[model samples]
Target: MRGFRRGLHRRSLYHRSLHLPPSPDAAHAQLLALHESGDANAAARFLREKTAAGSIFPGFLSSVVIDRACKSGDLRGALLILATMLHSGTPPPNQHAFASLIDALSKSTRLADAARALELMRDAGIHPDVVTFTVMIRGFCKNRMMERAWEIFQEMIKSNRCQPDCFLYGVLIDGYCKELRMDRALELLREMRVERRIQPDVVIYNSIVDGLCRSNRFLEAWKFLDETMVLQGCSPTVVTYTSLIRGACKAKKMKLAVRIWNAMLERKIQPTIVSYSVIIDGLSKAGRVYDAYRVVREMETLGCELNVVIYTTLIDGLCKSGFLDDAYALYRIMKRSGAFPNQRTYATLIDTFCRNDRTETALGLFDHIRDYCPLDVAMYTAVVSGLCRERRLDDARALFREMRLAGVSADTHAYNVLLHGAFRSERPEEAFRILEELGDDPGCVANLLTYNTVIAGCCLESGMVLFYEMRQRGIAPDFATYSALIDRLLGSGEIGRAFDLCEEMLASGLSPPSGVLGRVVARLCWSRRGDLAAKVIEMAMAVDDTASFSLPWDDEDGAAQDEDSQGEELGSIKDGATQEEPVP
Candidate 1:
């Protein structure tokens, strides 16, 4: 296996490039040594070349190599070994080697290749055994190729060399069940009993029950478990009861779930952790927290310790009911009882605590949990957002840095949170640093919200540069994007450019904020640029008739003087934005 992996990395196509013995027989010996020493690639190529040259070798050695290659997932290598055996023709390729080849091909979902290999085996006058058919049926069933699987089964029956075993029938039944064809699955069950006189076991019945439950045929599923399995003398396993219990939970039939649990116990079947988890989760989600506690007590009676899922589910129920104190107490109990909290466990308490104005408590809990499990991105992001909300920038920054030290990478949302917090705290340089840091992070990609945060926080010139970069990256700017740019433009006395953006915004099927629009045209009329102002109102009236507000162009009401003392410079700026000027 190691040699095969090495050969794959070498990029060489043939054994000629490899160091080997000169004589073909000696070369075969070296190949065997490589095969034994774990060099699959070189060994495979040597066999292929020897087979191509018709160099004689033992068929048993070829079979040994073929089986190992297939076992190691080297299908091409296995085929080469088979070819070498066929070419030598001393003891000829047997059914076992072909069966192994077919099994490997089927597992790889190369159904066509498997079929061809089966044909080759038959043409060589070697027939397939029960093991061969079983593997083929299992492969087809696994891939949901029931049609081809049925064909193979029928062919096997006609051959009459071996009778179909219970396992083979189980595969076919399971396949139909997974496909949700319960009618066909039922037919097979009947055939297994009436035609073959083979009694169905727990596994076969479990598949049918699961299929019926999944199809919402609860009554029929119960009938099979209660009547059919009992009559056939097959007892229901933990998995059998769990499927029905899970189905009841999904349907919100808590009464039925509990009844199924009791019935399983009546049969002296001990419920697994999964069975308990399913019941606990169902009860918790249904707002039956106290009843869920009863189930926990039952678990205690059996000396079954609670897991993270059980604790987390109950804690979530308590938290949802606004019982924060009880939730925290349960969290402490879980930690003390050897059930380590997962991300969901910590995140639930932290988020609820943060949301309910208990930020300090959430941070304390987070600080404690960090020593147990390496903090994930979600937990770190939640705490950072909460810290930012409380304006604790220093603590948030320390935690952000600690994320990297803990070998956890900050995602884009975390970066955006810090960027927003920096700006909200009036630290623009720190915000820029965050943006630059995001740029260096190959794992994180900035989304539209990130760009909006940066652009909203930056100066007009820098914001414009960043906006241009945003569009160049193919992140389409929304109304918020244009609104931010235009608002900055208007505030900076760049009314002409702001109006241009307003046109772009309208042209892109976006209605700029009415308040921003009115401000833009009003400033244009105030600047004595009546013609430009008129054009802006004309376009505005097209999308929204109310946007063409009546301008005081006549000055009959004694309006103030024009604000454009530097009309020529304003015109120059209007014609083209210059590098020296900070045009909005």
Candidate 2:
């Protein structure tokens, strides 16, 4: 009764198709359903049970199941199914199905599995079809395994079972082109024409041209394009012209691209969105925003509506040109025109706002995104970093917590914000606790900022003892770490100790910034050790030939220091009298 009930429950979940089709059809449908539902085990079980029940299993179904399992990356399951089909006296289907299995294995990107499938096909007395050869060749070429693909092609030719058609040649040409093996693609093309008696089509021609263009051989690609135009039976498609224009644009030969674009117009061929976007992106990247804008106007004139990507390009251009207000206005225009802002839009806005010191505006925009839109971790991190820079630690912490609650895993940048906030609140123990909490996250260990922030905190609150502890924990100190140590030592009036750190920085090939070196000089000057002070000034001059030092004095402090100095080596030069450096 329990078994019947379980069967009923399982039946309830399947289709109620009254007439049973062939076992292969039903099995194919069930397998497809299982794969769709992500129930690989159930799919496998259905195939086993039906075959065992003496159902008529077709060879094609077995081939498909094998292909399905291979493509799904379940090699063991595929082997089990293959064994069951073999035992059931089902012959492996037509050459097409066997080829499909090979294609599936190749698409899975498992070269060993593909090789094994190919071997199994040969052993079963099923020869690989043309599609099989093409797919395997393309797959090997994609992985830069050209040698293997070439060997298979040679073997296929030697077997004389199938002829290499135009499609096959196209596949190999495209594959080699994609791998940047232009020489191989060209050689294959030449062989196709002269040796194999196969003619070049637009696709084969385009593949060679595109490959040459990608290798920065625009001149070669162009020369080939002209050669293809004059080929006896080949005619250039719109795609051919677009490919040349795009290649020229990529090589930043805008004049050539424009000429091709005009030629395409003369031929009455329409430009695709990809072509427009490519030119617009290139124009914007090259700081030719005016040209990019002109393209947008041209697109409008051509009755092609501006897309979000086009507007984003315009916004980026405006922002780069120091027109943030204009960028913002264009952003508003983009929304009004029914283009939704994607993650890049948000990131650009946040970066622009922060750079303009409009931190509140950036945070407000971020807050809205946190409540709505699919959240991007990078966008959140950028905002968190801006808040930390602005010293709004509490707000930064709240956002960090919100990100975790939203099911976004806290990356190292988020952790850095929390550590910075903890330090801002003067809770070194809390900061240390955060680092301890991150011990389980392997990704956190690779974050240099996280390591630097925590190391800097240790140097500030605890000292080198914790700094060494951080090192023991496998956190390597960066330049910021050394700078923090120098800062802490200098703050404590340990100039000699600070000099040791300076030496360490120099040994590590880190030259402290001029501003930081200025601070060190100021510290020495205030110490009244005139000899050491002169040495620091001379060192600073040697490092920066253009730098000149002038002692800045406040009128009040100047009067006080002049009144107090009896001798250069006076112990406790009387606090009210010693010259204090003017605060900027």
Where model 2 places Cα greater than 4 Å from the true spot, the runs are 1-45, 52-54, 61-83, 108-112, 143-148, 158-160, 298-308, 328-584
Q: Model 2: per-residue lDDT, tens digit, 82-140?
A: 66666777675556655665676677687777777777778778888888888878778
Q: Compared with the true structure, what per-residue lDDT tens digits does model 1 show for residues 1-584?
A: 99668645542322343454466456556656777777666667776777767666556556656776788788988886675566566455666778888999999999888888888787777788888888888889889889999999999999998888788889999999998999999999999889999878889999999999888876578777778886778877899889898877776656556656665665566778898888778777777777777778877876888889989988998888788899989989898998888998988888888878889988998888767877798898888888878888777899999998888998999999999888888889989988889999998999999999989988889899988998999998987888899999999888889988988987776656678778878888899988877877777677665443332321433433332111121111112222231100
Q: Residue 440's C-alpha lDDT in candidate 2?
A: 65
Root-mean-square deviation (CA) per prediction: 22.0, 18.6
Each candidate structure's TM-score, on Cα atoms with residue i matched to residue i, is 0.48, 0.54
Model 1 residue 283 lDDT? Answer: 77
Number of clashes recorded per candidate: 2, 0
